[model samples]
Every structure is written in C-alpha cells, then in structure tokens.
Target: MQIVFVGGSTGQGGSPRLYRDELSGDFIVQGYLVTDPSDLAQMKIPDGESVVRVPRSLFDYLPKDDADGVA
Candidate 1:
C-alpha cells in the first residue's frame, strides 16, 4: 500500500483527508484511515498536515465521513 498526501492549494500542507462519504464527488476509491487519532499522529506528520494514507488492503476497512454539511 502506498501513502499519498492530498494538498490544499498545491503547496506545503495537504488538504484534510476526505472519508469515503465525505466527498460529494468520487470516494468509492477512497482508502481512508480507520485508526486511532493518537496512533495516526504517530505517523510523524507535521501538525496541520493532511494526507491520504494507504494500507496493505482496503478489502475490509471502511471509514465514516468527517466532514460536516458546512458548505
């Protein structure tokens, strides 16, 4: 599995990760994180950073949306 980071403006920090259902566009291909927040932090990513972390397989993991209906 490869970990990919999705950025905000096309510069440094990535745009916050989008869970499967959070994206109104396309997310059936999403491999969103389903780990503990603290553990996810252990990834050593700098604060305010956002990334799309991939694991061995998405054969058995599904994450809920983190986005609020705040458009």
Candidate 2:
C-alpha cells in the first residue's frame, strides 16, 4: 500500500497534489473538496465516491510512458 508522489499544483494558499499507488498502479489525487451544491447536483455521485477539484497543470507531470512498468 505504498504511495509515491506524482505531482502537485503551485497555487497559493492551497495545494492540489497527485499520487500513485505503487502496488495497484492507481492514481490518487488530493484537492479541494467539491462542495458546491449546483456542481454536485449535475453528477450522480455514489455513496462511496466523491470528487475533488485540481488544476489541469497537475497532469502535466504525469508519466508519458509506462517504461518503468509501474502502470
């Protein structure tokens, strides 16, 4: 269950970060919780699932290839 840093946003006051699960090859994102009622109303969120908002630039650091076989 080890997680490694993938990237992060440089926003002031708040930071949105991304992480990768080493064993499961899954992505974990840390960002502001979506609390806007109007925004949440548009999506059918399940009981166990939620959403967060992050800067698009955060994805720029994502690995472009699976050369490391971590994918």
Best by TM-score: 2
Model 2 earns a TM-score of 0.82
Instruction: For residues 1-71, write the lDDT of model 2, one tens digit per residue.
Output: 88998777665525688889988888888888999999999999999999898888888878877876354
Deviating ranges (above 4 Å) for candidate 2: 11-14, 67-71
lDDT of candidate 1 over 1-71, digit per residue (tens): 33333222223443333333343433433334546788776777777765455544442233334364222
- Residue 14 miss distance in model 2 (angstroms): 5.0
Per model, state how many residue pairs clash.
3, 0
In the predicted model 1, the residue pairs found to clash are: 7-14, 7-15, 8-15
* Model 1 residue 42 distance off true place after TM-score fit, in angstroms: 1.7
Model 2, CA-based lDDT: 0.82
- TM-score of every prediction relative to native: 0.23, 0.82
